[model samples]
Target: MLLRRGILWLTLCLPLYGETVAGRWHAAVKTPSGEEAYFDLEVNHSGGEWQGMLINGRDRNVSSAGSFDGRKLRLEFNYWDGRLEADFENGELRGAFTRQSRKQVLARPFRARRTPLVSPASAPSVDAGGEWILDVGEGGGKEMWLASFEQDGARLQGVLIPVSGDYGMHTGFVDGNRILLTHFDGIRATILDARISDGRLVGTLKGSVSAMVTGRRPDKAGRQELNSSSLTTMKNPREAFRFSYPDLEGRVVSSTDARFRGKAVVVSISGSWCPNCHDEAVVLRMLYDRYHAKGLEIVALGFEYTGEKERDLRQLRLFAEKYKLPYPVLLAGTTENAQQTLGQLRNFRVYPTTLFIGKDGLVRRIHAGFEGPSTGARYAALQQEMTQWVESLLAE
Candidate 1:
């Protein structure tokens, strides 16, 4: 009876011994460009299990698992290819956000503190909305983000559309001239803090890297055509789209294989280390499931950063398994190797350039980059466009 009582006492005391990391944490990381990025994390417990949810822009990714080992807090986001390890003390967390790849591990310093919710009630003086253009970097290194914001009093929700893809959905509140937006998706965390002055928005894009940002309300011009097929082109149109590479199990697969012959195939040139590639994979999976019986097949040609075959294969396997990809993901070799193997193509500039081939095995369309779900109407439009294109091809 005494031992049972002691066990109960110990169990009760455990909670008092450690600082609970529950609730909301405002986190920041310094990027290589000497900029600061920020995000918010909400930690909770349910059914005796601890988990977390990451909010970045409009994207919400739930944590696979999270645990606190008295002194250290560890959160695992398996699908996003990264994890966070931190030391909890004095009501603050200090550690690093590590992005894992087969070739290297990139880590950025991370720190967070418990903070009150940034809600509409707390921010009562903000009045800004509509579409804006976010110009990041400068000169040849410049990139633009088409942002659409919907503001209801102090509450704000919006999406940032970039060339590679959109930053999903972002939510936050505005405080006077200062507006704060954040998104966290297990693997990637982004925070935007901007100030409106003289009808111009100035802020910073913070995450693994930080960059200065400036924005202004767009003119009467429509949304820019950020994605174009001309971004990646073929050097020789007559050359039959062909490739022979080994799958995860070392079985040689080729464009002429029986599984793909006489079918509409999409050759996705991608890399495991790329977030954009992950987005493309998600869309490809949905398309394959919807049209596979209609003579549709997708072959993902992974152009891994790591030149080592074994390591690259491992990464591809992880990617395929995580997404439960039904189609074959062949290692077409490293990024440099892709240039040589796909010699018929010129100036391959993107990680997820998609090549659509008709039933005749001739390349029909090449889509460079991906818009993803963050682009709102553009994402839906692209989906509709691709679906219609596929249906047309199948009918022919």
Candidate 2:
């Protein structure tokens, strides 16, 4: 009788001791404003190893690795320095998603439940083809987003282009009139849930934040225009851009330092907290590797979200180490004080505003914002243009 009781207990607790969180989980993250953003996560165990993939819209990002020790589960999304730590109970996962590189350890509440994969034969079919203009937000804070979608049977693919930047490629499936799409780029995850009614797309946009979205095909509309010029007014253009800030080691570095003198410099106004800045950093690293010996010098002035200097510097150090950046990243100020910190420039609009200075120390161009990889051809074109411009500067 005692042996039988012990055997029964072991059998009952076996799943708790093992990786029971394997398989598909339907997740919904609640935004601070009480809106819910949904996603699908597929976890697998093979050869004594655990793997996880986050499926949003249509983008699938495989986790670098994951671990499940009974009740506690941890997943790492290496591409964006993100982590999900949670607890499993009654087939439900509840925890937080964090950007591990940040100093403050900001976390968003995340929850998921086990779900079975729907068979293709039983899946609902809908067509999601054509261009759409999405009106996002409400009241006086509305914004417009342009989207292009293509569908084949149940498979759906599309891109959402917002004024700030594109949301990359999203892939998912359409079941009847209800449509779900998602995109995850390491640092951020976006989910769109909508239904087709009267040939209009009505949905909820859930990403870094949540918003109600309504989209429609226009009778006649051209591609949205982008502001092309980078030159911003400065109180004095002839005067060299100047600043003195400490690096991660508390070493005060000045713009007028000998290392930057006579070099065609790229001064990047960036932040460790910005995803667009991350994309720009990758490009800058490539440019530095290619042109550093040819008189190019890149310096980043970081205006971090964390106001605490020590924490902010720690975040910057992590960012630098992660990307293996070769340039100096100096502490400028917090995001709130950015306008004042970079007061010398006229109308500095974004986190990744860049200033190109010729060897003569005159500001040549001030490119505001970045058109990341999601823009596809636009990103390639920008790379070509910047490379040519850098080459010209080197020759001069």
Best by TM-score: 1
For candidate 2, report its TM-score.
Answer: 0.78
Q: What is the per-residue lDDT of model 1 for residues 103-187, given as tens digits with 9 covering 90 to 100?
A: 6787878788877434433554545688888898777877777788889888777877766566667777788888887665544
Which candidate has the highest lDDT of all?
1
Question: What is candidate 2's local distance difference test score?
Answer: 0.75
Give the 10-residue window scoring lowest on summed lDDT in candidate 1: 116-125
Which residues of candidate 1, in runs, are more than 4 Å off? 1-12, 15-19, 33-35, 46-49, 101-103, 116-127, 171-214, 221-224, 336-341
RMSD (Å) per prediction: 3.9, 4.5
Stretches of model 2 off by over 4 angstroms after superposition: 1-13, 22-25, 40-67, 75-83, 98-107, 114-144, 148-150, 168-179, 183-225, 228-236
Cα lDDT, all candidates: 0.77, 0.75
lDDT of 2 by residue, 1-396 (tens): 999999999977866765478888887555544454556788888887778887765456677788888887888865455788888888788998777443455566888887623323436545677678888888897777778777877877677766545666776668788777765544556778898888888888886647899988866865454453443557788898898999878899998899988889988888876767777888999999999998999999998765887767877887787689999999889888888878788877666788888888888777766767755666777778778777877777
Clashes of 1: 14
